[model samples]
Target: MSYLSRSRSVYGPTTSTTCLNKDDEDDDDGGGKTDNNNNNNADDHPGASMKQRTRIGTWNVLTLAQQGKLIQLANEARRMKLEILGLSEVRWLNFGEHRIPSGQILQYSGLRGENAPRHRGVGFLLSAQAHSALMKTRVRNLTIIQTYAPKFSLSYDAADLQDKENFYSQLNATVDRIPKGDIMICMGDFNAKIGSDNSNYERFMGRHDLGEMSENGELFAEFCGNNDMVIGGSLFPHRRVYKVTWVSRNSFTEYKIDHICISRKWKRCLLDVRNKRSADIASDHHLIIGEIRLRVARIPRQEERVGRQFNTRRLDDTTVKRSFTVELQTCAADIPEGGSVEDQWTAIKNAFNVTSENNLEERRGAKGAIQRSKTRGAIYSARQRYSALEKKVKRSCRRDKRAWADSLADEGEKVAATGDIRLLYHISRRLSGAKINATMPVKDAIGQLLTDPTDQLKRWFEHFEQFFQVPARPPSPRYDPPRVSEPIRVVAGVRQGCILSPLLFLIVIVEILVGAIDREPNRGLL
Candidate 1:
């Protein structure tokens, strides 16, 4: 079987259906099936058939602040059947990893500071499959140093020059960190047009590129050349609409500013790259997808967690509350009391768990149900209308179509602002590139960054243990006489960030110190 046909068998129509024919020289619509017989010597490349074909893409999602944008991005990923989606201009505050409700993992990096404005953020959204395949993640200044770069605007100010310098420096550092044999893809909006000229840059770029070369293009080409990376976007032949990545605000101009570049050594793995123009992402930039065929060893899947949460809201009802009270009284009365404190506590906990399980409804899918609202249909329709009008304006340069597109954009924003929150969320997600939570790296006692989640959790535990420990000291004498016949025994565990834990720890310390002071020889010091 040919590489394309074998890839199609694994990824299916989600990618292959829209693919441009590799064999057909004159194919223009960017749609043609791969012929297996065209490349009959498939066995020449040993182990090619065993390789899994993965689709990865990049997009410059202007910003990602509005709610529900992450979910929308995930939806788009599913539609494209992408394993990983690289994002630019995410504009989220700080660096972090957020696990969306849809099981996708989002890792992001941005400017750090409590007072920092949301700007120039970059991230990657991984499908569950990709998340499972992920070996590690490294968050740096701009690069996930594990997986990504942000977009640079087309400006030549002193600040822009400094920004470009810092970006390339960090990018170089990120590339250096990647281990040998690992696939590295550096993609984003560089705001540079390399044009169709491949003269000196024959190895790094291709003649299929669009527009005229800019100064930024030279810098970009130089970076790719130095890194031995292939600009995938420029290598593939596609229609004008499928080649351009960004369209002007007035729909009068378009540019292929966004690009996906892979290491030159693994360039053959990049089977195809093109602009997915029909993807309704609400951004001026189109989704640039690339297909890579790789022979990857399967990683063990993480264990799934299944836990029940009671419907505590049901307790608000008087009848429900009374019934729960009666049930708890009955269950508590039947408890045998000959066990240790821990055993007794466990019994009590079990009683509550059993009672809640029997009496209360499970809060399993309530949030999910709310998220899967009908507003998505409406938002999708609005986007489709906008896309249709955009294409019309581009083709005919019709003033009416351009005006209609602008009006639709305005109307969509207005509806998002005033209409259903779900609709607003979808719109925001469609506009914003990716949704990610702040996942600041934790450091151990020696200041070594803890990257593993397990290590991070352990560090938090160690921190709380030290934080809650009260120092032992020589006690001062007490004036009062002892009145209690028996000592009170108390067991306490500190839960970090809980309001009551600090108060409980303080009370425990006070009791212990007071008792010691009462038995001290020199009480005057107190």
Candidate 2:
């Protein structure tokens, strides 16, 4: 099928997607050669290839339009352990790739206005899998080309045929452009259906197809065969449900139109392919997952960490404070006449760190809390027990923190009794809270604490909005007591020489005139 069927006519919202790839294309300096030696000359710095066993997936996420949904996408990607994920139907504007805050590289293409071109777009979220959290560099050559072809129409007209031809022609040219040494993967919706029959296409496709092959399927299979690419989804055996990549909204039909194919030279890399029905993104198509084993040519290097923090809160004790001061002084004395400024700074830094290490306690609760469970999302009874224990630990930590706050509050009361307002203010702040962490709770208008960063920002916005906008107040009530006639006095007349005399007289005259006008609406300047 090369074009959409007339029956599935364009009615509802079009699918928007994005594609992300960690693999790289050849640099212009390579002169289009596929030699590994030439690719390693430092100039052809390629991204990380799938040289190790890793999971990759593709899904047609209807749209990434909702607020805070992008993080959810990243979280799901992490949960699925997918290193490279190709997305379809991403409704975003602009086209390019950049590293997100999550360290994943997101590459995408979209149109300027409300709708994307041809009711489709490409997006990708390539996870940063380098072992070193500091140096997220990938080295090696590999390419993944994702596509969404025109549908197969009921009437095989010239336009439909021409569109299909254009897609395949471009696809063929793209596949030919990739460096031969670099592994190439082509996957996406092809609008085709190859039945279980794998007659002449056995070299590329297997006998595990979903349904009867359509005209588009025949052409698609022919295209793959000509390129020497093996269809990953068909090679593996799976239940019909697991094999189906798309299901109709009516729940009456299913099709495995989406496929992941790799060049025959790298066929051994693909371990398995299946459809995951549970990964919901408000789409009818199920997520297609594939496992591949790759080889890396370089080992990732990790950067060194420095100046780890100790529990300096212990320094609050008089004894500990005195001990730390003495140790710091001792260390400072040993700083042998420094060589350079940088060296002297380094020595001083080391002195402080060493003294703290020797005097203060080490912090362990947070590190232990995260490292306690290595196997994420494990559903075994052990996982349950670990979860329960984790909650208990958090509760105890909170209890201890509250107790500490209580003690600080009592101390603050004593300081207040001694008229130490500055210390009391600091203590009050500690007893309250600060935005030290993203997960810190902030009270909202309804008295509920909001932990979500977006919600907290909104609450703060509301507060600042009212705080900066001055409010209107009623004018002070004017009082005028009954006056009695008296002789004029000349004692206050000498003040006429003052600079403000004329301005003050003008203000009093204007005020009286305004009051007279208010009492008599017919009064005029005349």
Overall lDDT per candidate, in order of appearance: 0.61, 0.63
- At residue 16, candidate 2 shows an lDDT of 17
**Tens-digit lDDT track of model 2 for 201-289:** 78898988788898889878888888889999989999887899886644456888888998898787788899876564446678898
TM-score of each candidate?
A: 0.53, 0.47
Q: Worst ten-residue run, lDDT, model 1?
A: 4-13
What is the Å distance of residue 325 in model 2 from its true position? 50
Find the number of clashing residue pairs for candidate 1: 5
